[model samples]
Target: MQLAANKGFATEKVLNLHEISHSLEFYANGRLVRNDDGRQRKFQGVSEVIEFVKRNGGERVLVVLPLDRVSEMNVDSIEPTFIADNGALALYAVRVR
Candidate 1:
């Protein structure tokens, strides 16, 4: 959240179905989005939000998660287009085709 904020990405408060069921902070604009909290839930919350947003006309979403969660989360189902390692953070980009 701080990194994106420092980079000038605006904070978007998401209060909807997915947020109620699973707490996942998301920030985005144009083709990229970043996940703020990735400690308690792992990929379930983030993936759910991504799917919901994509269905509602989103594309090229990038979810930023903790580095340790790389092996824990189920990436096979979500199938991110690309994964980038950034020291303590891991970014999963979902590019809709």
Candidate 2:
């Protein structure tokens, strides 16, 4: 979430979907389900992230921290945020074409 970090959405403590219990992860009948609590915690979860997509409606989520933060998770399409875009160390966070 390098873009999110650049945009000031980064958290001091970060966790991904694989790290949490499946129950905490939201899945909608083989699809992604949403969870409101994801955005508020130090660690972000799949269900919570799914919830963000619902409320935000695919607006644009930026990555500004580390690629590994999301590498193991399931997601597609991310718009680059300015700060992360400007950072030279952000190449790892960019989606490979």
Candidate 3:
């Protein structure tokens, strides 16, 4: 995320997911960005994020998830656009039409 921010992409939201719900926190300029709507928003998963990208007319999706969940998430089913390993974690940037 720091790298992305350094490259000029705003770190808009961070999601903390649980079994039943997720919390999203926004950040800007290295500080927390408050939400006029509300402090917390519904949590979204990788599949939901893919839908969002598709809905916004995006052709690709970048997903950062635990390495253990890679198979659970069916990441191998699709060819990844980019992948980076960071020990037990990984970053998956893939084209999703």
Q: Write the per-residue lDDT of candidate 3 for residues 1-97, one digit (tens) a residue.
A: 4544453433333322112112212222222222468543322455665555566566444445566656534654344532454565554554454
lDDT of each: 0.44, 0.34, 0.42
TM-score of decoy 3: 0.47
lDDT of 3 at 11: 35
Best by lDDT: 1
Question: For candidate 1, what is the lDDT?
Answer: 0.44
Can you give the TM-score per candidate against the true fold? Answer: 0.42, 0.29, 0.47
For model 3, the superposed segments whose C-alpha errors exceed 4 Å read 1-44, 73-78
TM-score of 1: 0.42
Q: How does residue 67 of candidate 1 score in lDDT?
A: 67
Q: Which ten residues in a row have the lowest lDDT in candidate 2?
A: 88-97
lDDT head-to-head 2 vs 3, winner: 3
Evaluation by TM-score, superior candidate among 2 and 3: 3
Clashing residue pair totals per candidate (backbone < 3 A): 0, 10, 0
Tell me, by TM-score, which candidate is best: 3
Candidate 3 lDDT score at position 38: 50
What is the alpha-carbon RMSD of candidate 2 to the true structure? 11.0
